[model samples]
Every structure is written in structure tokens, then in C-alpha cells.
Target: MYKTLIYDFDGTIGDTLPICIAAFKKAVTPFLDRDISDEEIVSTFGPSEEGTIQALIPDHFDEGIHAYWQAYKELQYMAPKAFDGIQELLDDTAKAGFQNILVTGKARTSADISLEQYGLTKDFKMILTGSPKGPNKPENIVKALKETGTNASDALYVGDAPSDITSAHAANIKIAAALWGSIIEPEKVAALKPDYTCRSVADFRQIVLPE
Candidate 1:
């Protein structure tokens, strides 16, 4: 069992992918003459909001981020919901003495809004958001481990993206694939060979807290 659990916010913890894509498209519309594809938007997504914005709208990165969050925050609905059983999982993990930490590409403000909306603001012990000059995901993972006083051997990083897997691996941490929150094909994910593939909450519990 792990003593620390590091999580990715979008897609993994919060179902914000749809709204995020919409916001990205809306953000770039004013700057782009033509439509931007969803794949393009997703591919450019990095560990920080500004990183993604800069990739998408290098000419007007700051303006793009402002517009993106403006559209994103204005929407009351379509923010995101915690995936099925996610709250229970977090609660259980906490009760079992694991330190829950968050590493998100969303700006701290945007991440807080979603966490508050979902009533998950208190679930994490430490939160590392991707601000304009914040550390990237891999760096955040290292920080989470250090802050929580947990070693990589005693920590598990769960996420739904290839980048998350790569980051965890780079940080010398074990990684688990959240199949339920997967955005990529299962075959593709399988090829990445995560230490564990959690198809359901039960699978997650089995791997992280087997008794």
C-alpha cells in the first residue's frame, strides 16, 4: 500500500474534458482565423494553463489564457463532476492514512473553482497547480512526495493521460492507469504498460490498498 496518492485533476478526478475543450476553442476563436481541432487543442495541453495557451496562441498567449478562463469561469454548468466513486475513493484513501495530493495543469484558481463546485476542496493535503511559472507535472510529483514525506516506493500516481504516465515515470514513481477516465484508446494505454490498470474503483482499491 502507498502512503501518498498523487492525482491528476482533469479527466482523472474531475470530468472537465468536455468543458475544457469548449473553453479552449472559445479562447482561440478570436485569435485564430480558422477553427481549431479538438485533437490540436488536447495535444497542446501541458502541465500549466499558460503552457497550453502559449502553445495554442503563441502570438497572444496572455490574452488567450484570459479569454479561456473568462469563458471557462462564466459557465455555471458544464464545469465538471467527480467521476463515479471518486469521492468515496478519496475519503477511503484519506481514512487509510494516505496523503492525497493534486497535480493539475489547470491554473490554481480554475482548479479551486472546480474542486469547490464538486465539494472536493478538502480532499487533498497539498495542491500543485500549473500557474504561469509553476513547476510542471513531473516536478510537481517530486514536490508532492517531498512535501508529504513519502518516498516514490510508497507513493502511487494515478492519471488518465499519457503525459501523466510519462511524468510519473520520470519522477521515479509508480503509475496507475485510470481506465474509467481514459481519453486515449485502451490499446494505446496498454502499450504504455502502467504498473496497474484500474478499470474500476474496485481495481483501484485492490492495487492501492490490497488486504
Candidate 2:
């Protein structure tokens, strides 16, 4: 059994669709001279917010990223809701002697607020957020293992993006793709071929961590 489970926050644990779309729109409006559709915004869901913003507004990547977070923080505080059954999954995993850690591309301040607001703060052993200088998910996963005193083979990573699977593969941790979140298409996730694919929190428990 996996002793440590690392989670991705935005689309994996928290339903951040509203805030994310809002942020992207707010960040790009001034530069694009035309409104960005929610569909366009939603398509950028997998990457770090900064990276997404950069891709959408290249010349002003830094500025747009900063502005996006500023707008995002104001709106997201009230926007996030935990995915149904996630709380129960966390509880069961904890009871089964697994340690949970959150690794997100969101800034720490915003991530902390979201976790607390959704009552998820207590569910995780540690929460890591993106920094301009911070390492990517793979490096962060290695750090997480060291901090938790777990070997790579004993850890598993659950997330909604290709980046997450790539990071887990780089870190040599098993990967489980969460289909319940924002990815929209299973075929997109299948491209990564995670060790496991879960359609819901219940499926996660049964397929990825069966007793």
C-alpha cells in the first residue's frame, strides 16, 4: 500500500472552475482587446496559473500572472468547494495510515486560504505552493518524500493534469489521474497512461487504494 499520497489542489481537490475562469478573463482582457471565452480559459486548466497566463499573454507573463492572482484571490476565497466525497476519502486514507500532502501551483497564501475555507487544512500533512523560485512538481515531490521520510516507491501522486503525471513519473512515484476534476476528457488523461485512473472519489478508493 502507498504510505504517502500527494495531491494536486486546483482541479483535483478543490472545484476551482469559477475562480480560474474569472482570473483568466480578468488577466487577459486588457491585453487581448476582446473577451476570452470560458471555454478558452478552461482549456488552460492543467498548467500552473502563471504558466497558463504566460501562454495566453506572452509579452506580459509576469504582470499578467501577478494580476491574475490578485483577481483570483479576491474571487476564489468564496468560490472553492471541496469535491463531493473528498472529505470522506481523506478521512479513510488517514485512518488507513496514509499521509496526505498537497502540492499545488497556486501561491501559498491563496492555497492556505482555500484549504482553510473548505475545511481541508487538517486533512493534509503538508501543503506546498508555487513560488517564482520554487521547484516544479517533480522536484517538489522529491522534497515531499524527504520531508515525510518516505521512499519514492512508497508514495503515490493523484492529480488531474499531464504535468502531474509527468512529475510523478519523474519522481518515480505511482500516478493516479483524477477524472472527476477539470480535464473534461478521459482520452486526454489516457495520453499520460497513469498507473490508475479514477472517475470519482469512490473509484479512487477502490481502484487506487483498495483494501
Top-scoring candidate (TM-score): 1
What is the alpha-carbon lDDT for the whole of candidate 2? 0.80
Most accurate candidate by lDDT: 1
lDDT of 1 by residue, 1-211 (tens): 6788899888788668777888888898889889999999877667466777887789998799888888777653774468878898899888988898998878887888788878999999999988565448888899888877898999999888777788888999999987775354567767878998888767887877786
User: In model 1, which residue pairs have backbone atoms overlapping below 3 Å?
Assistant: none
* Location of the lowest summed lDDT over 10 successive residues in candidate 1: 72-81
lDDT of 1: 0.81
Query: In model 2, which runs have C-alpha deviations exceeding 4 angstroms?
Result: 37-67, 77-79, 133-135, 208-211
All candidates: CA RMSD (Å)? 2.1, 3.1
lDDT of 2 by residue, 1-211 (tens): 7899899987788777567777778878898978789888766544457657766899988788788878877786645578888888899889989999998877675687678778888899998777544337887889999999999989989888777788899999899988887544577679988999988878888854577
Q: What is the clash count of model 1?
A: 0
Question: How many backbone clashes does every candidate have?
Answer: 0, 0
Per-prediction TM-score: 0.90, 0.82
The parts of candidate 1 lying over 4 Å away from their true place are 131-135
C-alpha local distance difference test of each model: 0.81, 0.80
